[model samples]
Target: MRLFLAAIFISLAVGFVNACSPADKAALLAFKAALNEPYLKIFDSWKPSSTKCCSDFYGVSCDPTTGRVADIILRGESEDPIFEKAGRSGYMTGSLSPALCKLDRLSTLIVADWKAISGEIPACIPSSLPKLRILDLAGNQISGKIPADIGSLGRLTVLNLADNRISGCIPASIVNLGSLMHLDLNNNQLTGAIPSDIGKLTMMSRALLSKNQLTGSIPVSFSNIYRLADLDLSMNKLSGLIPGQFGSMRVLSTLNLDSNQFYGNIPSSLLSSSGLNVLNTSRNNLEGELPDVFGPETYFSVLDLSYNKFKGPIPKSLSSVRYIGHLDLSYNHLCGTIPIGEPFEHLGASSFANNDCLCGSPLRTC
Candidate 1:
């Protein structure tokens, strides 16, 4: 009787495995499709069934009760999806059928540092996958401009579209991403002015819009972003003054405005920006002397004011900047005498190169 009972128990286990519903079968199809996907080669050997646990699938995760594939993590994993056959990495080139939208419990979707995924992002991305918390399409070949209807994803928190060929203006509808904490759109071909209502993204912590063709000055409403920590607007065609409203930001730390066409003086109030530590105004058309408002005690570091039209005597107050390092004032109209200060004393004429009248310690005597 005991031997017969053991045989029956084993048969029931096999039957239970065979009786899994079509949902599990759909998951397996998706999983097999993911295996051949150039973006998922890192999981080539993954066999979730072998281990009888979702954790066995290298980059795939599942919902607790439904046991359906939900989250997909492709970045910072053990192995990069090999592109030896396709000649490019992260090449997830296939139609995103509505089947992908069925992942109702999905949360995060990271595809970083992959380069070959082409074609439009899943059209149903925003409207169907409402539970998505993070959506990173960074470092891919995604070519379409950000979908103007992106606001449909009300639950999205992190949106990264950096390092792509995506063109067109940032859609005004993006302001609808009320839950967003990080939005990176750098290193693309996007043009047009930043939308005026960008301040509506009060939940953002880090906002990157560098290396594009975007024009116009930053909006004043940006000052209201009390949670903002890092703001990068460098290497675009953006012009106009650094708004005084920036100084009002208590949490702002890094502000990069290098390699733009921005003209005029650095706002003295921002020079004394209490929270500011890293400030770059290099390769612009800025004029005027460095401000003393950035007291010696101020925490400005990594200050680069090089390749601008700034003229007049070097401010002695700058010598008090004990924390400053990597100071580059080359190729400016600054003249008169170089300040006699600790680090300034070591800088040579090369550091003040191409200046019309800069003389004394750094350069030759006037």
Candidate 2:
């Protein structure tokens, strides 16, 4: 009977040792103590009584082999059953704990959309979390500059800090993220020119940096990002000629440079590219005749060139395009009869309105 009791005691002791380590547990507790998630009680599961933090803790996951915490995904906007049960979204108000940097094994840390979670992002994250692959703290009230050493995370794939109050110039070291794929710093208070070598992120597919105080001409190196599909530099103070090299990008389809200070003619190669479907250069200082490079292969879903200084008649070549779902050429110095073709049949006078002397079936007769 004594032998049996000893065996059972040994088994229990081993199980306890295999559970979350003491240091990790302490770090997690400190991390939780900083935040208050009142509605869903998400932290209720993160209790000292539940020793197996790997399986028992909410929004926390650990490696099966090492029992080390690997991920902490807590989003305020989730369709989790907890949100459904509460009939509302998650809401947490507090600062992120620096203790999170203690979880050295953490691979993904996403505490996003917690509207009131305000504080500067812990600067030690990039150095402490070497295994981090995804760092999405977007849609929070987090303020401060992005970590300068963010490029140290060699395996990072997604870095989204959008819809926040983050300020300061984008760190030049950001272009060193060789594995970064999706970079979103949209709707932030970011200022200054984008990193000149941003195209060095060869694996990047979408680069969204709109609605900031960014200035400087579009980088000529942007054409080097062969995989980049969507590029939005809108609502900024950027100026200079839109690079003609942009027309050569093999996969770039959506290019938005609107509401800026760009000057010079629209590149003909941009209109000639068969892959580009959405091009908006509105509210800029761009002038010159519309590029007469449209062909049967041209297919633009949205072509907005309004509110510019473009002069000259509407390009007759535009009529040869396969499709142009939405075309806006208003508020320019364009004059002459609107080109009559299948592409222009559905367009209304508003498209050609406010032009210097434009006249056609849509507008008053010439």
Report model 1's TM-score to 2 decimal places: 0.83
In terms of lDDT, model 2 sits at 0.91
In angstroms, how far off is 90's CA in candidate 2?
2.0
Candidate 2 colliding pairs? none
lDDT of 2 by residue, 208-283 (tens): 9999999988888888999999999999999999998888898999999999999999999999998898999999
TM-scores, one per candidate? 0.83, 0.94
lDDT tens digits, residue span 149-255, model 1: 89878999999989878899999899889999999999999999998888898999999999999999888777878999999999999998878888779999888
Q: What do the candidate models score in CA lDDT, each in turn?
A: 0.75, 0.91
Off by over 4 Å in 2: 1-18
Best by TM-score, which number?
Answer: 2
